[model samples]
Every structure is written in structure tokens, then in C-alpha cells.
Target: MPAITHQQALDRLAAHQLVQVIEDDVASLTSTAMSYAKHDQHLTVAGYVLPRLLARWNCVLNASNDEATPLYRDKTVLALALLLHKHGMTETAITKRALQAIDNLNAAVALSDAFFRNTDAIKALLNTPALALKKRPSTRDSLTFLRAQDVVAIQLEQYYYAAYVHEISGFNEYPIIEFYRARFEHRPDMAALQGCAAQGETYNDGKTRISLHAVCGMRHVPDPANQFHLIATGITDQPDQSQLGASVGLHTISNLFQLQGVMRKTGV
Candidate 1:
């Protein structure tokens, strides 16, 4: 990197506040997007540096401890695996960790399920977590009321933006992928995702309890032994649209990832 560019990156990382640091990234991405419009080199640089960035992020995750659902960790390693196809110059650790996450996918999910079921497991899973489980109200909607199982998923979102961008961004893209393939003309089933907020079993067209139904689902594993299933076609209206457009084309529908479009629970 040139002196000016290197200094800029340092400055961005140097912000004392978290939001400021994010602003720096947003500015950098916005600039990168503008640069990409004028030259393909910007995009090429992004692709080349993505794995290295992901690796650094995984290192950050490894520095912490969390015994709950390893979904974030799993997603992180899987993403790194996809980007890092070859083992070279100390990339072996990342590859090994990522592969291990893949091999243990089923065990991880099962453990998470068990963690939710047992009271002792729940206590063990919390490094320091805030759990909010409201009983299903009689007159109120079930969609807004998270199930007891949702405690884990809520924790998944607690440090969501900070901790698991790679996994969330990568696995969460499935809904939009299917939505596009279907021409975005109809709603798809999203309930297959189990506790997913996008699943149609949650709600209907009403704004108070809008549903994010899944239209399609498929295994997104690195290998057959590890089945990393991804479901898509749920809808939501929250996401950073400017970031999405700057990163790629604008997606009108909000899927589970809230990045692209998700399908409605009911067929159109």
C-alpha cells in the first residue's frame, strides 16, 4: 500500500469509539465502491484481501470464549475455508480450524439444541449473556414472541455486527440467492429454517407481525460429512442499503441476512 493509503487504514482503526471505527469503515467502503466504478482493480484488491481480512477476524474470535451455539465460530471458519482454498505460508491453521468446524457442524448444532433444552447447559453456555424469553401471549402474536429456543439466537445477534460478519454474510445470503433464481415474483417457504425469524410459521402479511418465509433451502457445506444447511426467502426491512448498493447491486427484498430480498411466507 502507498503511504497515504496505509496511514488512512491506520487512522480508521485508531478510532477510540466503536461507532467511529465503523464510520471509518463505511467511509473506506464508500470510497472503494466509487473507485470500483472507475476501475476494476479496486474490486480485484477486495477479493484478494478478503481472506486475509477474514483470517484476522477469526483470530479475534479465537481470542474470546463462548460455550453456547458455536454457529458464529462455525460460520467464520467455513467462510475462511471458502476464501482460502490452498494452504500456504502459515494459512494451515486457518484451514485446519475451518475444516474442523465443517466436520463438527452436526455435533455443534446438536450441542446447541441440547444446550437450549437443559438448564445447566444454559448456565454453562453463557459467558455473559442476556436472555429474554417471553411466554406466548394469548391475545398477542406468536411471531413477535420469541420461543424459549430463541435465547441462543438472540445471543447470536448480541454481538452480531461486531463478531460474526463473515458467517452471517456468507450463510445468510441463501435466501436472496433463491429469491433471485425464482425471479422475485412469488413468496417461498422459509419455515424450514426452524427458529429463523424469516420462517413463515412466524407470521403473515400484517406489519405488526410480518413474516419472513423461506422459499428455498440447500446444504452449503464444504464437504458431504458436514452439512451446513442454508434456508432463504424471508423478508425484513432492516439493513444497510447504502452498504449493499456500494458492495453490489441493490436488492429490494430483505432476507434473513437482511441484505438481499427474502420471500413472503405465503405464495403470491
Candidate 2:
């Protein structure tokens, strides 16, 4: 894989439709502050902004095509967190609002038998390590909320990277697990990667060699059979599979890895 320039990466991110959506939403949310000022009322991040953001995302998720449902839902949650933070919401408040959105969406999915008719499949999807949203501590009043916020922030970063990859790669249908596994394999030092933002190593999936960014923010566990399993939280309902070894796109891997580094260094 060849190295890309920082300008190139930023340009791609700027051109991405998801980023555009986020920017527009941020602008709109900021404009709402004017209305609050006029009414002599303080803007409520939790009670008002959060719910409105959730509703908009609910509509986005509901309107998503079946094939892109997982990607859409994951990115929507990430986008929601970004918007809330941009509006000056606290970490605790963001965690509570994000968890509420996740629960509501999961409940809605549970109600729909069409999404997963088989009980075992539904259980597998919902019980997967990646979908373990409830595992994060719910004590929003304590220091634990900070920990929860950190975990959720990392998860959101992973989702954002995945969404960026999906969009730039022309929406290829690779398994989410494999995508993260590839990311884990190419774990680059995020601090250094941010300095360049365009450098990556070529990954060979035995069949083809593709340029991939050395992104971070994914957690992994040892798998006896597969060597490693990516802990792809907040990104997909798909269970990990030993059979998936497909190669993702060049720009997909390159940009995500670089963005991960940026997120880590800036703590954004």
C-alpha cells in the first residue's frame, strides 16, 4: 500500500455523506440555541435535544433499506453521540441518551419477528459480544459513568470508521466481523498515524493484497480457532464467524485507521 497525504484523508472525510449529515445536524442543533435565547429558556441537552436527536435517528433507521440496516443503525448512534457532545452535553448525559436510544432500537428490533424469526438466531444476534450495550455500567451518577462514556466513545469511533469505509468502498457487503478483524490485525500506533494520516500497509488476505490504514479503537480477544476475534461493539448484530476472511477496500482501511489515530490523540 502506498502512503496518502493528510489533506487527502481530510478531503475524503469532508466529502463523505455521513459526515455531511453530521455537520448539517450540528448546525441545525446550534441554531436551536437561538430559539431558546429568544424565549429566555436554557437549552436542555438531556430532556429536549437528546430526544429530538433520537427521534430523527429513529426515522433514519426505520427508513434504511434491509441490506444497510446494521450499518445505518450503528452510524446513527455514533452520529447522535457526536451531535450531543457538539451541543455541550456532558459525558454522563451523552451516555444516558445514547443508552436510551440503543435500548429503544433493540426493543423495536425484538418486536419485529421478520428481522430474525428463528429464536436462536435472534438470541445469537442480540447476545453477541458486539451488541453487549448493557454490559457497560449504568450508574450515571458515579465515576462509573465516565468509564461508560469512554467505552461508548471508543465503540462510536469504531462505528464511525466502519461507516466511512462502507461509504467510500461503494457499500460492499463484507461481514462486519471480518472488517474489524482486519482492523485488529493492522493495529497501527494511532499517535504516529495521526501525524501522517495517510500511511498504511498492504494487507494480504491470502487471495489479494489491499492497502489498509492502521486504525485503532477496536478491542479484540484471543480466539483459539481464528487467532483473534474483534470485539465489534455498537457496530453490528452479526455474530463472529470463523469463515469470514474477505478483504475490504483500499481507501476503506486507510482512512479508518488514520481516523482512529486522530480520535485517540485528540481524545475526541
Candidate 3:
């Protein structure tokens, strides 16, 4: 049979239009979850969603040899997370019944973007979330950026950061620099960072544009037990811009890093 597009599947709800067999499976599982939810089989509903979710998660990270996959694990997981959140947060009966009908529209962002690519439609869709929240608020929430003022003068400080060299927006389109920024926001001034360059042409004011030597660095305190309470001094952000600086530090992290999803916890 001729396959149908994902759009057709959503627009028509005609199972025959499903292009990929995976889409069909998602739909079928959704239907089954709803049926179970309708009959107040909440635990069974979890049984249906969680396993499929994990299977998708495994495939997302290529942890398993699953044939079917969900590209936007953020969305699928966020939806499930949100559903579970709502189930616990609200007393409404409808959600408890329609647990399968996820409300996050952000999930569509990645899908449509992949499908349309450079189209203006992709841009528009990204800015237009059905929930209308920050697009990819994970880093913003998880990590903090520090300024020069908040620097704490103490010992035992440790450093964790990531480095990247990007092509300038209007300048060289490409530039070579082996520098890093301390993004952790817990304490800014203590980051030992000096004046950092405004990478983007986003300086609305003339002074911001003219300023040189922007403080760029990264700070991470994963386990506070080994806490670096005071600023132990960073390598690169010294007084003069003549420092070769320290080598970029990296930790072998797992895929288990928390996804800053929209699912709010209780009283959150």
C-alpha cells in the first residue's frame, strides 16, 4: 500500500496514510493507552507508555537495536513527563482519561524542521510553540553564567567547561581561537573571567560594542561535597590578554544528563 505522510496521519487520522510503520505503532500504542486510561487502568497505561518510551530512548542514544525510533526524544519524553506531571498535579478527570493526547506543541518543532529544513515554515514553527515557552530551555536552567562581580575569593574551587570555535556572524564567517567560557551561573565575579568579547553583533549600546577583552569561561560544581567554595583562580581570565591559558577541561558524562523539559514538578 502507498504510504501516507506524518502530516496526513495527523490531519486525517487515517491509519492507511501512515508513511512509516513506526508512526503506525506509535498511533496504535497511543490508542491502546487511551483505552486503558478510559477504563481507569492507570498502571497499565504507564505499562504501555514507559516501555515504549524507554525503547525509544534506547534507540535515540543507539543503546538498543530497535527498528522503530522517535527522533525528538525530548518531545516524546517531555510529553510523557508532562503527562505524569499533570496526573500528579491536577485533579481534572479529563487528563486522567486522555493521558495519551499530549499537549506539548514543541514536540512538532524538530519534526517539521527536519522535514522542511531551510523553509521559512521551520523558523515560524520553532517560534510558535503551542505552549509558547522557551525553545530548549535546558541549558539555561541547568547551567548558570557568572559575571565578574559575583566572584567569591576562596580556595577549593574546581572548573568544568566546554569550548567551541564558531564562525563569526559578520566578521570572518570562521575564526580560530582556543578559548573557553565559564557558563556556570552560581557565581559570576569569582569566575576569574576578564572582559569577554561580544561574539554576536547583539550589542545594542555603542559602549558594549566597543569594549574589548570580554570575560569568557565555564564553571561547574557537580558534587558540592568537593565544593570549591571560594574562587581558586581560573587560568585564562587573568589581567593581561597574554595568557596561553589552561587546557579545556572535559568530563566523561553519561547520556543521563537531565533534559530541561517543560514538565513542571509539584508547586514548580
Candidate 4:
């Protein structure tokens, strides 16, 4: 089957009222917990967590029962951890809760051999090539081009978040890294400012691109907890360059780390 476009995925969500259902699910789950000192605290985390969960649930629901079970289980661990953390649960407590629900986290980790194996977006991304840029385009044209790429990055971030929560076997990284690399290569100024030179670029005077290295390093981290911290830190420490660059960096790092988790689990 042909992969769905970003617009088609959005349409699917709207058609099924998927956002509302997931939002309601989060609300219902949090309703009994004490309200945050400030409501936005909960809103902030929900904003971060829901869209990804919705994407996963949408894919899982459409998949076969056998395929959905393990996907659902993996997502469940992530969802519970984020939700509990929003309610101010400590890491130790959160680990305990996840452990109690899961027979063995390591065994569950071993069930899958790849990050985002069950997500439709990953399939779509794998099939799609990096965006091709036109030379000397107008400001409007450039904006349109960047926006198109951003949509794919948005979809990738969902799966990246899922992989971060529970370790996976392998992460398919080529398409995603290529997507960002195309953008950087096309705009060396942005690339230099973001410290993400394309392969073999001498613009940085032989200093390795820190952002690029960060993504590659994720494949080596064995502990999910440490890996999670690394990813969060990367997002927070992103250079304040173009907003699009920041967004691309965020998703790119996520893809790399998830790929890393997959590598660690599968010994790749």
C-alpha cells in the first residue's frame, strides 16, 4: 500500500475524532489525581504526550490484533510514565508502577527489535525521500518548502517519543537524517549557526558538527533512563537558530536516539 501523506494522516485523525478521544482519555485518567499547583503544568505535559499517543493508538487500532498487542503494550508503558510524571510521581515510584504492570521491563524491551516498527508514519518516512529545494525561490516559496518538511518531522517526533519511553531493537534512521541533511546542505548559513554541517563540509574548519554527533551517539547508550535524559537535554540545548532548524534538530535527535535504543537492544 502507498504511504499516507501528512495531510491524509491529519484527515484521518479528524475523521475519527482521535484527538478528542485521546484528550478525554488523558483527562479521565488525571481527574482523580490532585490538580497541579498550576493547571498549565498538566496542560504542558499533556500537550507533549497526547499527540504522540494519539498517533500510536490510531496506528494500533488499524493494525491486526496480534500486531497491535505488543505495540499497545510498549505505548502503554510510555503513556503511564509520562502521565504519572505529570502527577509528580518520582522516577523510582514511576519505575515501580511500570514494573508492577510489566512482568519484566527488560523482557518487554526484548519483544521488539526496532523502534517505530508499528507506526505508519515510520513506513511513510522510509518510503519518502528528502525534500528537493529549488534554487533562488521567493520568500513565500521557501516558507512553503520548509513547512512541507516540518510536517514529516512532526510525525517522526511521535515515534521518536515512543522509542524513548521503551527501548526498541532498531531504528530506521537514513530517511530522517537525510531529510535534515538536505535542509542543512541547502542553507549553509543555517547549518553553520545550528552547528549541523553536512558530511564532509569544511565550513566548520574541521570541528565536528556537535548536533550531528549527538544523533550518532544515541546508538551507543544502553540505559533507557540515561538515553531519555540525553534526548531531553538535546532538545533543551538546541541553538536558537531558525525555528524550522530547531524543530528539525528536535526530531532528528529523537530519531537517532530511538535508533540507538534499537541498536542497543538488538546488539546491532
RMSD of 4: 21.1
Instruction: Quote the positional error of residue 89 for candidate 1 in Å.
Output: 15
lDDT of each: 0.28, 0.32, 0.28, 0.30
**Native-vs-model 3 lDDT?**
0.28
Q: Tell me the alpha-carbon RMSD of every candidate.
A: 20.5, 21.0, 19.9, 21.1
Candidate 1: where is the Cα deviation over 4 Å? 1-48, 67-71, 83-92, 109-268
Tell me the tens digit of each residue's lDDT in model 4 across 1-268.
Answer: 4454433332322222323233334443333222332445445433433443334333433344653454344434434443334333323443344344333433556333332233344334323442322221111100011111111111122222111111122332222222222221111222232443222112234442313221322222211111121222113223322422222232233333234333322201
* Rank by TM-score (best first): 2, 1, 3, 4
Q: What value does the lDDT take at residue 57 in candidate 1?
A: 42
Point out the worst 10-residue segment of candidate 3 by lDDT.
258-267
Q: How many Å off is the CA of 168 in candidate 3?
A: 59
For 1-268, candidate 2 gives per-residue lDDT tens digits of 2132222322322224454444444444444544554576665424444444433344444433642455445445444454444345434544444445444545556323432233233222222222111121111110110111011112221222121121212122221111222222222332222322211223454443223332221222221111122322332232132333343653342222224343333312
Q: Which regions of candidate 3 deviate over 4 angstroms? A: 1-19, 41-47, 63-120, 123-268
Score residue 152 of candidate 4 by CA lDDT.
Answer: 19
lDDT of 2 at 25: 44
